[model samples]
Target chain A: MKAFETYHPIVLFAYFASVIGLSMFYMHPVYLLITCIGAITLNLLLNRKSFISGLKFFLPMFFIAAIINPLISHDGEIILFYIDYNPITLEAIVYGFAMSIMICSVIFWFGCYNVVMTSDKFLYLFGKVSPALALVISLTLRLVPRFKHQITVISHAQKTIGMDISAGNPWQRVKSGIRIISILITWALENAIETADSMKARGYGLKNRSTFSLFVFEKRDGFLLGIILTLLFINILGSYFGVTTYYFYPTFTELTVTPISIGLYISYASLLVIPIVIEIREAIKWRSLKYNM
Target chain B: MQAQSTARADIYSRKRLIFSSIIIFVVIPIIMLIGVTIFNDRKYNLISMIIVLLACVPFFVSFERRKPQAREILTIAVMSAISVAGRAAFIWIPAFKPVTAITAITGFAFGAEAGFLTGATSAIASNIFFGQGPWTPFQMFTWGILGFIAGLLGQKGWMKSKIALIIYGVFAGIMYSFCMDIWTVISYDGLFSWKRYLIAMSTAIPFTIVYVISNVVFLLVLAKPIGEKLERIKVKYGMLNN
Candidate 1:
């Protein structure tokens, strides 16, 4: 429910970079599982309360993913069910489950990031150089909730007028939906005009714009940045040397997993865990401060 | 009276040109990339050069007009990018998968031009992020039409009702699937006969279900919110001509 929470943007950025880097280089099922687990565990640790609250949003999606993914992906070995010529394999099921886990973990991480990395963090990082771009990102984030709220109001108003879209057949429903959207279009255009005028009146882009930053790079940020830079350097080197390679299609073969690959994977997986570590450390620090007081 | 009318008309046409030019410069190359990938099996690197060349057109035209402030233009460009990212989020939503409703909603909210941009951009960008192949443009056009239809219908007030949105979503889904199926046939070419198309349909049935379900869910979650915000924006900004 809170709009923003405190966390280091660099750490979060590093974490995402590492996860993406690892996923690209080392894409084994087992390694993916570890990454997923790490993501979920961190998600739970950081956003326990929000996770509980947001379960409604996530639960239906999880079920849909679990059931639907396996049905669509007709791959893997160890057939479990045979309907007509199609085979539903256990491998496919596990793959789907893993995929769902991966997706959910990513979503949770995004949610955490959204909470922690407020527009201020973005502005802090890139505002000075690209104020216009930073402003747009901030506006977009602000717009999401505003847009959601507006839709609710419009639908309610329409319902009162007996134009209930939910009460109709499929074809009629489409017609009615178009009508509502037309209204929305007019509204959005008008809003854009007002935004343009307001921004103009305020003398935006009059000269080179300077941005204000709230976050001062501290010792912890420096330490985390150094770790991230080293890890990224290592990851780049690994990729450059052709350390991780796998072939699919004509035949599937796994290249020998070197110590470097394992080390990189661990580092990548641990990157996602860093936020949770920071949160725990913060909680401990807060508790000690309270005790001393 | 004739002279006055001519002057007003000239101004209006000039405004339209400015707007259209901006859109063309920003959106056309993105579309061309999709076109090349679908029609020809070329990699995406080729499109980057095209983008650079095409991007200069907008800068030149905008610089010529000098009516709309640089910040205003930048804001539009930035909004366009965010819209692209938002549309991409729907794909990453996992359960939603790839559905026509996103195209429809985008088209309905932004208009045909923006809808086209959203459709094409989402297709290309998602493919690039996930992994690109030849089918990218086909998917782009398919989704682009969904938005185009939504915008076209929305402009006529057809998308105002919930029933209409749902129906539009379903129709868009069907159109998308049908188009994708055609592309499959084209890709397979000689290997896929008339009978194979039928077989392919049967195979694609599950995906069709997912598409429909995603469309329905997306409309249910998004329609009302998008509608109201857009209305507010319209009123506040004086966007529509009466």
Candidate 2:
């Protein structure tokens, strides 16, 4: 893990929320290309093994999302072909491809988010703002993997008793699975009840209780957050004011590279590449230290 | 087996729900549409979406405050977790989902309001494991509606039959794909076009069929035991008296 990974969880979450928000809120093709490359690269850098494995899921999603646009959108400037008496346009196809990349890359970023935003980080981020809802959401996010593990254990135990879901005929197996689930539901409710009672006994939600957290916002984190927000604000302002606008409708507009847009582009790129830059800097420092050693 | 004591407490909740549903599902879109007509700008769609998502906060706040017992709140959380996990369990099966079945049952046992919250919550929560995007809010609303219908209609005489549940599953499957297809159509064309929507629907029929099969399969497998357990919990705890 890089030094960036060890920052206060709130800093990390704010970075993600801002970055992902940019991906969704900004539709400029240039901005999108930068986002696509940055998200995928950072993701691969984070974990190459998982990134490759995720290709099996992301490729199809990209293609489907990309292809569907040209199929339905016939209002583009460059008509490519006619399918079922409707015109398919090159502009639409290109727009669709951009959109798909936008979606897939955001998904890649979220895949990274899943890795970095552990349950503790998630709880800390929301706990201060909305305690009750945060507590519930953290519990739910935490429970999912636990529930999956429970399913495996239950299925294993059932198999030992000759009541495996995979063993019986289809209907009988389904029935058997439900029987297992019946046991699981009882367990789940009882488990939740016990948790609730435990919290109650601990004086939760009864008064203003002070809690301690491990994360403290350092000056480095302050700088990081300030830079991210400043760039994000500038980029959002550019788009919101239509300074970075492009048309893909009845007529496609040329993708102009004006000075202002170029600045916006730089801000957006720098915003996304912050993590990569940090990693590269750390790598150079480590190499220099080794040479000195 | 729902108790009589809670009905008076919940009547206000039901009233507020109906009012908010109209406001969320009907009035907001109409306002956006009117704005579009006045300005001749379709960008109002984003404004409308943001407004509706914000409205969810108040709705949830009401759910939190009026929630009679801590048990029901935890129950909803656990059910949402189960639905998310169930979706993850079927990761190998593309487009197949047990979410609808479970969400539908949550509606059936709980009232329409709880049903909507469960469906919506499950969608958002599961997307954390799957993916979240512009599609998240739409998925939340659509699945919430499906659950509301199941709760509103599923508890009655014929609707309670297994055959009817299967039929509802099939319809729900199509409805989900169709609802999502609107996002496809609008995002593709920048406006809701009938021709585009039709093509989108036709293109997605295969996925819809999988939804049908998966919903039926999972519902058949899940509803009875989960439903039975939920009902027993409700009666034993005197929950959701309305």
Candidate 3:
């Protein structure tokens, strides 16, 4: 496991929640830069190949999202040009760019989140809040792979009967597809009954049913949680004080660099940099230990 | 046995009615008020997400309170997993997914709460494969509401007719796109703009038509067989009858 992911699920969840939330709400260019860099860097550290490949999808989306606003919105003082008679304004373009960046940063953070918060971690976290629903989610997650396997089995069996989905006319193919799903439904539902019977046999839904999990909260987790909460509190305070709010409509506000605003920027940066720092530290520690060996 | 089961149904529907009323009447308004006043109409994505999550809480709380049987929970799991797998089965066809049909069928057989759970759970579970995004909550809420409404309408006799099913299929398609587009418009500016939303909707018309067609086709084709199968399972396993 990576160093950051090794922390308690609570800490990881909180960190992603706060970072993604802040990324969505804060349109300040500086804050966006910090978050975008942090998210990209963290993603690169965690999964470099996938992060680079994701850009192929995100790049077009980013440009489309950024381009659409100016075409539709004509709500600024500085008019750029007429597009088929409607004036596109500087403010609209700027707002579009900012919103696009915000959207991209949030998506990137989620990429990082997806990497760090595996389904097991997510289910573990969710299990604390709603155990029954969590179990339902867990069971569904488990069943998806099994169902896929069963689909293959069922399809092969059906193929032998000349009802092959891939080798039929268009209409026949559609019929075969539906038939496969139909047969799968009957098979799954019938099998589910036996699964439930086994569960009942094993004393499911009993009182005070204890769930076994591997996660345990250590002192380091508490300390990391403390740091995250503190930084998050600072960022929220900064937002509440209107320091993080940037205006792109009507007229652009002059970028101000007050001490308090600077402090808020640093705090936000530090918050995002926590995981990157931890990963780097871990890498360095492992390198030194390897050298000693 | 019949009288007792009817009594149980009465209690179940009553609890659901109370919860829905509280959410629709009180909770949603208060949330809108807060969203408008405090958020100044920004953060529509976040605010609506919170609202969606809040709307689902009552259903789950009641489900938990009822001490749901293993088979009951397994039924929901099985239905949700099927919907997720259904998406995979139809992966070749872009914009054609049987998730809504399966979820709606589950609601038709099981009840609104099970339908809602199936819709919401499948949304998240499928995202594990497709990748989760800011739109996950919106998708969950949209599909869940589709199932929820399907369950309510399924309780009536007329929803079994072909015309009613067609109407519902079109409605579910439009509703899914409509709900999903709110996030699209909001994601652009962190607030809602009618002009931008109109543009987004106009551009999305082709996809929406596909959704409507696919939903109708799937519902008409899959509804009878799957609904019958689900009913048989419920009867055989005595699932969710409480």
Maximum-TM-score candidate: 3
Better of 1 and 2 by lDDT: 2
- Model 2 CA deviation exceeding 4 Å by range: A56-90, A145-172, B1-52, B131-134, B154-159
Chain B superposition TM-score per model: 0.63, 0.86, 0.89
lDDT of 3 at A114: 86
All candidates: TM-score: 0.52, 0.83, 0.95
Best model number under lDDT? 3
Cα lDDT of model 3 by residue, B1-242, tens digit = 88988898789768978987998799988988876775453767777777877888888778777777788888899999988987987789877898998899888887788888899999999988788888888888889889989888877755688898899999999989888899888777677878878888988898899889989988898889988898888777666754
Clashing pairs in 3: none
| Residue B71, candidate 1: C-alpha displacement in angstroms | 10
- Greater-DockQ candidate between 2 and 3: 3
Best prediction by DockQ? 3
Rank order (by TM-score, best first) = 3, 2, 1
Q: List CA RMSD, all candidates.
A: 10.3, 4.1, 2.0
Task: Give the alpha-carbon lDDT of every model.
Answer: 0.56, 0.77, 0.86
